[model samples]
Target: MAWMYLVIGGLMEVLWAIGLKYSDGFSHPLISVLTIIGIVTSFYFFSRALKYLPVGTAYAIFTGLGAAGTAIIGMVYLGESISYIKLFFILLLISSIVGLKLNAKVEA
Candidate 1:
């Protein structure tokens, strides 16, 4: 359950990150509102996960997921450049995330 919350939070982190790109420095009214909402909602779920998960592991995974997700989305949907180096690093980050998850023991 806590892992589920963490995943949701990480996805929401992706949303808010994309939202930031579309928000245009907060000058775009509707996107800015949605981005703010995304930010709050992401934090809510992340905090829920923190209640049960190791903070160090959870936070590393959270930010790592966000960074990797955002990078992928940018390349796929936002016309951002894709390169082999980026792909390699994204894979590395994902590997590290899994490593952390496996090593961290739940409090239960």
Candidate 2:
């Protein structure tokens, strides 16, 4: 399903994003290679999902999911801050993505 692909892409986006932090500016060869693989896989799924989903809707959902998921991963795994305001915005992003997905279903 397109939604499944989109979610996988989002997860890969999060993986690469966190991996980037450990890459030491790409000096860490293993982490850098993993990061590159993650990014490529993320785009591959994203592009595949676009074949069935509208570009505007799919892209918005993809980036929103990536941003929110990556932020949560950073907070939990990387011990980044999780302020009330930041939490509120993340929730907003999730809501927006859900709304877009619902809209896309209705459109189809």
| lDDT agreement with native, every candidate | 0.93, 0.91
**Model 2, C-alpha of 71: deviation from truth (Å):** 0.7
Superposed model 2: Cα runs more than 4 Å off? 105-108
Q: Please give, for residues 1-108, the per-residue lDDT of candidate 2 as tens digits.
A: 899999999889999988898998999999999999999999999998988888899899999989999999888888899899999999999999999998895124
| Residue pairs in candidate 1 whose N, alpha carbon or C atoms collide under 3 angstroms | none
* Winning model by lDDT: 1
Candidate 2 clashes between residue pairs 3 or more apart in a chain or in different chains = none
lDDT of 2: 0.91
